[model samples]
Target chain A: MPEFEPKIVAFCCRYCAYTAADLAGSMRLQYSPNIRVVEMPCSGTIEHGLILNAFEKGVDGVYIAGCNLGDCHFLKGNVRAIKRVAAVKKILDEIGLGGQRLEFFHIPASEGTKFAKVANEMTERIRQLGPSPLNKNAAGNAQKEGGQTV
Target chain B: MIVAQQKPISEIAQMISDCKKVLFLGCAGCVTVCLSGGEKETDVLASAIRIKRTLENNPLEATTFTCTRQCDPEYIAGIDNLVKDVDAIVSLACGVGVQYLAERFMDKWVVPAMDTKFAGGSVVHGLWEEKCGLCGECILHRTGGICPIIRCSKSILNGPCGGSQYGKCEINKDIDCAWQLIYDRMKALGKLDKLMEIQPLKDWSKSRDGGPRKSIREDVMIDE
Candidate 1:
């Protein structure tokens, strides 16, 4: 049997994690290719519906990376993001999707090495957890249609 | 305003487990103000149900719609077209809204997503406290704008019950004795003499004990 590779979606704040991702590329840091990044103006802009939408679209794991605590460019955007992430985690847990599948991290823009590290860490963590139950059938269908597993 | 809290997702999921498709109706009224049943809550609930049913292989198709105020007939009338297509409805409104919607669409199943809590206001963002007892009477003027009917654990109208100690209710130490609040307010307003005036026996007929009640304004009635 071929190894299962999980699909992970990361909502990265433009002020921090997005810049960190760019810096990681320039620094030639190696990271897993499975992470798909959606750049947002601020972490506070990541709504509960957007995270749920990602799960609905068959993503195995979701993470929000934003500026470190007390370091947000918008004063309290990261604080709001933390609360939103906690709220979404509770909903995910209640819906039978383990809360472990979702994560929130504080990262500085200069942490290019840390950005690559999180990508590989999240990819590995999700791979161990396997695919989201919501995506089980969809993954099967995709393999049947595309003649390959994503 | 009416305050409410959402029922657990597990209980909600169980209520509509037999349903393949459901419409989550949100109210932009009291429930919205209390942060329980509103547009954001409606979307969150729809997504949660979709995820739960999908994992179970039952695959629920959930749709969401937010009305101006579910308790108002005019607002609910606007969603009649959407209601006809769904098998069941999960109304995210106060008890009044849920019953109103159910009565309006007698043939369809309408279930409440929120548990109507009380007539209250927010103490702060994300926190609400009961303030009114809906006793069908107003006595705030005599009590220095503090209500003893609901705020008092024992509903004592005359004075603080013997159970009050250190200005806290005996029922819960966290709760302040309503009479204490009234006394303080009365003192601040120089209306301490009002407490000496005996209150008359409350007319129970004006409240829920009088059975289902209605208020009609003859001037607003339309001739047949």
Candidate 2:
């Protein structure tokens, strides 16, 4: 939103957040372009590995947006997604990413403004956190932490 | 159910290194329903092992097979043809299944691919919490269905420990206070009268302390 452009990945449930993003576009609501949305059949489909892989591939922040908690198209799918995200957060915290980099939220398919807000909020949050520890300048240290040979 | 989790890929790869022909065994009982050592896990483990070996400059042949229930001999007999030519077996089952496979295929090396966790069930999908202590005895009739022996942070068989705070275990903020849950459930069912009844000291002999327990019934035995 300013001089700093933060990189982010948004995992959108095909039933909700993805449609919300499409609605946001139709409304011409301008938000950060930094977020690359990865659409899933259900947000519950996102696994712990996919989240870890995103950070490993250098994404500064990640979030999964799904149908509001009990409103999942496939009943209870959103609940599963929340549990998976919480589990991944534990691993992220253990690995010293501060655990705040991973997040999950719920929104209705019609809430276009909420989509924009979430985007702007995440982008701003990552900006304040600064370039990821995995950024080029400190990538060597991040690689060791990522358990990958850089 | 016997709870188990997948071992790290690298460590599993290391376990079956020298074997050229490997038999991948899957258990369809507890592990299949739990998604740990089921057909999917069996295939994944075999594929990962094959891929890792090829990538590490060691080409190996991998074959996969799943048993209806790996803990029983009748089900294991079905794998005779599957294990015929494989150099070794990597079992994606519980420790019981591994031993069963070893006993079944006495001549072949059967390796375990999962670390058995506990006797538990899922409170949420993909989350299996220990629900049963398998203590060879059950006392749920008196304390409501909640098993303090398994779900309680301290495994307390009585009432709430002083450490519980607001129905949460003091040992870990994430853990639910098991006795509190028991109390609430009992109260709701108009069964609080049972709490005052003292539970006797558990007979540890009924559990693993009994040393490799087994059961048999001549009436159910097969006859030729």
Candidate 3:
């Protein structure tokens, strides 16, 4: 069986995680290239769909990196984002994806180093967890039980 | 506003067994504001159904649309042109809209995609709690806008019962003691003295008990 490289989607808050990623770039920080970052204005503005959509599209792991609590550029945007992340975590559990696959991290604009660290850490973690059960060639089933798209 | 939550996609798919032509209807009023049956949810359901069909080899034809307000006769009339084609119409409105659809189109099978929770408003974003019991009574004037009937776990008209510990309900520590909230609000509003005003047991006879309830206003009625 060929080993699968898990596809990880990270929803990054534009003011915090995204900018921090840009900073990591300027500093030439090397991290896992598997993570595809989707930038949103504020973590709070990300409807639950974006996270679910990633998993629905067969992404092995999804993470939401938001502004540090109380530092949300839009007042309580990060707080709302936290709640939404928590909600999606439950949905992932319901859809046969073990809850651990989805992660929510709080990152401040100043924490470029932490962002790089998260990328490395998440990559290692997902490597150990293996591919999503819904992945086409994943071991558990030749295809999903119902072959449901999401 | 009437709030509802979408049924899990798996359950909704199971409900339409053998049905290929499905109509996904959304309400743009209360359910939209609450994020249940809005355009986003409509799209989500449509996508979920489409994906399931592709995987299961189930031939599915879904026509997605949303109305201004499912509960309003005028808004419902807007869908007259669409309902004629689908095998079943999945309404994303509350109980009212489901029945309204059935009444308007008795020949078409109508299924509810969302469950009506209660007459609650958002506490934060996504979290909702019942605020009005709509017992056909108004006690806000006396309670300082806090509803003891719906907020309190016991629906205690007069309370903060001994079960409350540190202002949290015994039922669930996460839930705020409704009586505690009411007491605090009334105290802050300088209406603590109002607690002494006893409220008689609610008259259920005038509520939804006897039959279908109705309200009439002689002043507002038009007479030929």
Candidate 4:
């Protein structure tokens, strides 16, 4: 049997987290290859339905990476994202998905090292939790696309 | 507009515990304006239910649709084919919408996902306050556009009732005295003399006390 490598989706804001991920790659930062990044104009635009849709699509875990407090390029984008993430977290727990499976990180544009650390942390956490219960064929399919970011 | 809040997901899940497929119906009228039962909320609810059922190893197939106004029979008629295969319907509209669905689709089990709260408008982005009492009468003309029936702690027509203090109601310090507002408005309009006149007893029969009421427009009715 193939090993279980959880698939994680990361919604990253272009002004901060997305750039930080890019810098992480340039800096030779070693982290788990389980993450699939979706770049957004601002994390505030992250809809609760979209995160829930990702879970329904069978992702093992999901996270939003936005700017640090008072650092959003759009003034309060990260602030808005934080409140939205909290609301979605509550909904996820209500739906029996375990709110811990979803997370939010405040990573500024220069925090390449922090971005790598978050990737490793989320990967290890999800690996211990195993694949999502929604994924019926998780054991058979998790390793099929181990390093793909789609 | 009617304001409502969505029921807890646990309660909603319990309602459909025995069903394998369901349709989530959202209303685009008052519920939509209140940010409770709209198209986006319908989709989110469907996803949540599907995820919950899948996690429990009893996968549920969910579909979503939004109507312009669920209270109207014409909009309900449009979804005849959509309800053909669903085991139950989860209505995200207010009580009226829920009843309409139940009446229109007698074979399907209809459940409400929101608790119909009150007839009011949004005070802020996410805050709603009850403004009207739905007393089956309009007395805004008499009270300077403020309502004493719903806003006052006690529905006294000639209010201030010895409970008003510092422009606030005696029930809670946070609530403004309704009669105070009426006085201020009337004073500003130079119509404070209106307050001196004694008001007669209200006709309670016009309100919900009279039982379920109906409005008919015979002139607009089509000849059969």
What are the TM values for chain B, all candidates?
0.97, 0.94, 0.92, 0.97
Candidate 3 lDDT, tens digit per residue, B44-89?
Answer: 6765565466456675788889998888888999889898888899
TM-score-wise, the better of 3 and 4 is 4
Q: Write the per-residue lDDT of candidate 1 for residues B69-184, one digit (tens) a residue.
A: 99889999999889888889999999999999999999988898989999999998999999999988788888988899899987878878899899999989999999999999
Looking at model 2 chain B, report the run of 10 residues with the lowest lDDT sum.
Answer: B47-56
DockQ (C-alpha based) per candidate is 0.83, 0.05, 0.14, 0.86
Give the TM-scores of the predictions, in the order they appear. 0.94, 0.62, 0.69, 0.95
Name the runs in model 4 displaced over 4 angstroms: A1-3, A141-150
Put down candidate 2 lDDT per residue, B36-137, tens digits, no spaces: 898877865675555455545686788888899889999999889989998899998899999999998999988889999999888786788888888788
- Decoy 2 TM-score against native: 0.62
Taken over the whole model, the C-alpha lDDT of each candidate is 0.89, 0.82, 0.79, 0.91
Give the TM-score comparing model 4 with the true structure, all chains together.
Answer: 0.95
Best candidate according to DockQ: 4
* Clash-forming residue pairs, model 4: none
- The better-scoring model by DockQ among 2 and 3 is 3
Candidate 3, residue A10: lDDT: 82
Off by over 4 Å in 3: A110-113, A124-150, B3-10, B42-63, B81-85, B120-205, B215-224
Residue B20's C-alpha lDDT in candidate 1? 83
The CAPRI quality class of candidate 4 comes to high
> Which pairs clash (backbone N, Cα, C closer than 3 Å) in model 3?
none
Q: What docking class should model 1 receive? A: high
The sequence of per-residue lDDT tens digits that candidate 3 reaches over residues A49-93 is: 676666666777888899887788999988887887787676555
Where does candidate 4 chain B have its weakest 10-residue lDDT segment? B194-203
